[model samples]
Target: MEKMPAKQYEMGSSTSTKSMQPQKFLHSKRIGHMDSFSRHEMMYDPPSMESKSMPRSSYFNSSKPWPDLESDESDMENEIDIDNLPPIEVGPHEHRLQYTYWLWFSRKGTHRATDYSKSLRVVGRCASVQQWWSLYSHLKRPTALHPYRDLSLFKQGIKPMWEDPANSKGGQWVIRLRKNQIDRAWENVCMAMLGEQFLVGDEICGVVLTTRSPECSLSVWNRTATDHASTTRIRDTLRRILNIPVSVPMEYKIHCDSLKYVAISKGPLKS
Candidate 1:
């Protein structure tokens, strides 16, 4: 037979046999141990406690405890006790609400309004130095009070007005501050009042702040208007405490004069 031309076979020809791939086998875990495990015990048993060893302080070797260490531990226990204890319910008085009195009047009017009055008002102690601060901090600032409000911290029972028996024969050492000066003047005066900086402490009845259309003034009222020594001492002391200029004169208006002016203004007007 004549040799026919050899046919060229292409790579990946259909005539080529397909290679067989090896199969993978998965082995089962041993079933022998499965019978030993108990699901209920595994799920339900309590966890083991953490292995924290007791400190040297807890060791029973020593009969007495170290003072410093014991104190710290006691403090910690106290803190824990405090934290666990119910919070105390504080009352209004326990919080210490305080009020101050002030005398306010119009120069041209008869009716003067005062925060100081005979009516019983809740006033914290005005006796000691610290008590004064307590009053100041808890009470409203002078400027924050109503325009008609005036604060007078006098010996208890003495009224703030000139008509008071204690104030009848007296006068006031007045310092005039402009409208713009109200805030600073109030602060300075309040500080002076609280600090008890007046020299004639016995002569001083109380302090007053008068608010007017154009200006506001503060005065330290004294029991005796004619007593120059007392007046001079009070004036000098107030000036020093307020750091006012020596040249600035503080006017002394006798309580008598104040009452008279009020009387005349209130008197029936002649037609």
Candidate 2:
């Protein structure tokens, strides 16, 4: 009366097994249910919303933690501020020069006598740096100068003529600045002279600025025409400081030699 029958026990065991199997499968199947799917999506790919709808601090404010949108946004704003900032001024070496140009009008080969007279009437001797700029700022660019027009710049004490005692025996390291290179070329010339970058130093009598057809000219003058050492140093220094391109050629000429070349090349009357 107390023991259960074997058949009855078997029936109970089979029924329990069938119920347990279905129960196990229910968990997996239920994962696709709406709430379960929502949970899954929340953990994975949630919908995107406009950044503006959230607290402004969520993106830019500095006061939050975890997903500190505030700090992030503030950082981004700061980055934009930095990016939009005006350029910082560095020292001279970091900056490219914006040059001021001077124009010269010569009565002889440079221009017609009438034009020379007009320029002379309007031109005043510019002795100081400020005065030079005042004169230069109003003048035409080098490339715009007349084909026959010549422009020259000399130190305060110096004149453009070779006969000037300071220049009489002097030589020049000449770079013919093509019309296209007027800006950089003229800047280099001005930097060299004003900075006194020439190795010849005192041998540096002055500089000459001339604009002619097809080119503008910048010449570094030395005190001694026959001083080969000074002339060599001058030319080498120019080659280095100007960072002159290898494709372009340069020439060094003694004033005496230049005069001779002019005589032979242009004719006796021109010389």
Candidate 3:
């Protein structure tokens, strides 16, 4: 096939920065079982004790920094051949995640939205490890996205919007990085989510990734920011998963705050 049409996003325009040193975390239960991602059949089972061991290396290692997404003169230099690359997940399994997730994309920023609902588009949905990897492999990394463009993966029926009932009471943990260095952090965060390492049970709603000049941020949304116990666990788990350094701050914002401020960044940036 001729070289693929020019990709819509461009990465590596600026120097990269390393994330924080991740604290050592004890391994949690391996992802045990789940139902399919079909909208109607979505059901998550209770965590099982029959947890499998996933080598630290299989996912991101808290000990090391992740690779940066950079390219000079060509997209091929940054592209990974999906067909030839090793599978992030191997084969069909007997289990699935508790909920099917849908990936949403939008170049429209909060500034462009006459209607928040109309600005975003659903890219696809996934319920299995293989399925998640397949979807991710086809998409551009967060770093490749233009400033203000965002990618959000939320539970099947839950739109990324704060207005969604499932997310209305919740808040998100934000990880900020330089524009071209978001892929590694983005990958590790998604893997940890898809792997069910948060141990917050079904409290997790989904995650959103957005890029801006000088900063690319990924945020994990959970059901109740008021539930301090669950939210704290989610926050700390995210820190280790993303290997966020202590020097870099992580912000928490209630969905209600978004509605109040009418600016997505305001919620997170508010005190």
Candidate 4:
């Protein structure tokens, strides 16, 4: 893939692109913790307790619309006697992605005192369709996590924090939603990123999900803060794919300003 030149934003710049790949960005560039005013709209939840020791069905939410994973497929075309049945074959059916991505889990705002660098954990890395689904299926949903926890997804080797080299000059588009709103929106954004449906260049780095008591925010980090054209392209794609209501408000901010002003500032950050 051809690398695109990223736009750099100095400290205190107002212009930034809108995004929702989520945990929050464009507002906390330094990385120990995220500012409330962080920009984004996508959400993810950590793996369920059982997922770690023993993988379980990914769809833990009883309210989930789809049928259970076990019973969806049935009825074979050919029939054979039990005594002489043909042996099954195992082949490589996994679908591959352009980049191997990593999923991160942490409790950023819920326990502000905890060290962000230390708490961030990589659940796993995936480069194939089967691998992605296997990882996602075992994890818990956003609604299942504690209000203070967060989830993030990014390309392998790229940390989701604002201070990471890949994200320093970039910004994100943030989307805020009530606790009840993260389900479908989260899934949509994941699919979009994995599918590379955003239509922009390699500008997108990753996305994050931050959950607080009352609501949560989803943010998508891009590689540039001043590339207005590319940023707008991503924003439009996000808007269309997310089906965000016209009435909902969106905001953009740069990592430099976020790090310099949002973080290390005494004032309370906005969600």
Best by lDDT: 4
- Each prediction's TM-score versus the true structure: 0.52, 0.49, 0.62, 0.63
> Which 10 consecutive positions of candidate 2 have the poorest summed lDDT?
1-10
Superposed model 3: Cα runs more than 4 Å off: 1-95, 109-111, 246-248, 263-271
| lDDT for 122 (candidate 1) | 22
Write model 3 residue lDDT over 116-142, tens digit each, in one string: 775565554566654555455556656
Question: In candidate 1, what are the lDDT values of residues 1-271, reduced to their tens digit?
Answer: 0111222111212211111000000011211111222222112221122322222122112233222211324323222211232322223333211222322222222233332233212222343333343334444444544444344566544667788898999988777655544555554455455344554556777776766545556778889978888888888776654556564545677889777877788779999
**Candidate number that wins on lDDT, 2 or 4:** 4
lDDT of each: 0.46, 0.45, 0.58, 0.59
Q: In model 3, how large is the Cα lDDT of residue 217?
A: 74
Runs in model 1 with CA error above 4 Å? 1-125, 179-196
User: Candidate 4, residues 132-206: lDDT per residue as tens digits?
Assistant: 655776667787777777789998668887788989999988777666667556765776787677767478998
lDDT, model 3, position 120: 61
The TM-score obtained by model 2 is 0.49
Residues 1-271 of candidate 2 have per-residue lDDT tens digits of 0111212011112112222221231233322322212323212211131222332132223333222212324333333221222332223322112222223345343244323332221122332333333334444555665555445655534556665677877777667666655544554455455444554556776666666665566777778867777776677666665565444455666677655655575554542
What 10-residue stretch in candidate 4 is worst by lDDT?
71-80
